[model samples]
Target: MLRIDGKKVYLVPFEEKHLVDPAYYAWLTDFEVVRYIGRDEYLKPIQFEKVREYVEELWRNRYCSFFAMHHSGDDAFIGTAKINYLNEAGFSTRTADIGIMIGDRGYWGKGMATDALFAICNYAFNDLSARKLTAGAVSANKAVIRAFQKIGFLEEGRLRKKLLISGEYMDHVLLGCFREELHPVI
Candidate 1:
């Protein structure tokens, strides 16, 4: 099991047990939890079997890595993070996309996302030899955007009125960070 430790949290390979956990499923279906995820408007609540299959497939995909985030002090499962190569050519491009979701409501607003982002970014830059990392969030999700920015991510661009959430259009904020800009917390 791969594990990356940070000041407030640790990330381990997302596994079968995580997928089957009731909390995991609940987080996915909760509108409040995933409103910024930007799933197409026509999409319905996620199905269990489909998520299982997708996770299983991810396990074999060399270009993507998914991790389950846990609180370091109590070992509480709190969220998930992923690093995906931007091209099929893999490391040749030296670029990747990083995303994270803090699932447990109790962990929100406590810097858990920032800690996890630092750890994941360190892994991407050092372990994976990635030169640049990118991320995006719905403009209204200020917390997420701040977390990324706090970790040295710079605003890259924005897609104006690109996402429809709760019957309102919102901009999609794009961010990017070079390896040198990352401040590792792990």
Candidate 2:
């Protein structure tokens, strides 16, 4: 179990307790935030149930990990971050991908994402032997791109028409960072 903490934020292992909250459903239903992450519709209880089922499967893996982000003020849960694709084959053994979301729109532009990324990556590299990380952003989202860049991820390339969001195809911006070259801004 990986635990990273700060004055206002902390990251903990994703658990069944985290999903028991009703706010998660509200966050998953928020169109502005879910526009880039979820399918066209809002995620219902059954949907999150499925997510829980899938996550439990992930927890049984050798390297698979995910965290539930929480705040210190209200102790309110904000979002989640996941490090999947934990295979031992090839160079993957040294690398782990990252994905995050701040479910509370009220916390937007407050550097919570930045804080969470820094804490998560620090734990990943030093604690989990993670050497590299990557994240993707759909064209409809500029905040995700900016957040990734703030963490020192450079624009590797764009995957054309990779997502169908808001009823049309959208492009994907691939961003990455490595242990040898972690971006300071991150």
Best by TM-score: 1
TM per candidate comes to: 0.93, 0.86
lDDT of 2: 0.77
Tens digits of lDDT, candidate 2, 41-117: 45333477665666677778766788899986787899988776557652355767788999998888988887788
Q: Cα RMSD to native, each candidate?
A: 2.0, 2.6
Best candidate according to lDDT: 1
Model 1 RMSD in Å is 2.0
Per-residue lDDT, model 1, residue 45, is 71
- Which portions of model 1 miss their true places by more than 4 Å? 41-43, 184-186
lDDT of 1 by residue, 1-186 (tens): 689998999999998889998998888877777888765521467688877877787788888999999999999888899999946765688888898999899999999999999999999999988988999899999999989999899999999998888889999999999988887433
Name the 10 consecutive residues with the lowest summed lDDT in model 1. Answer: 37-46
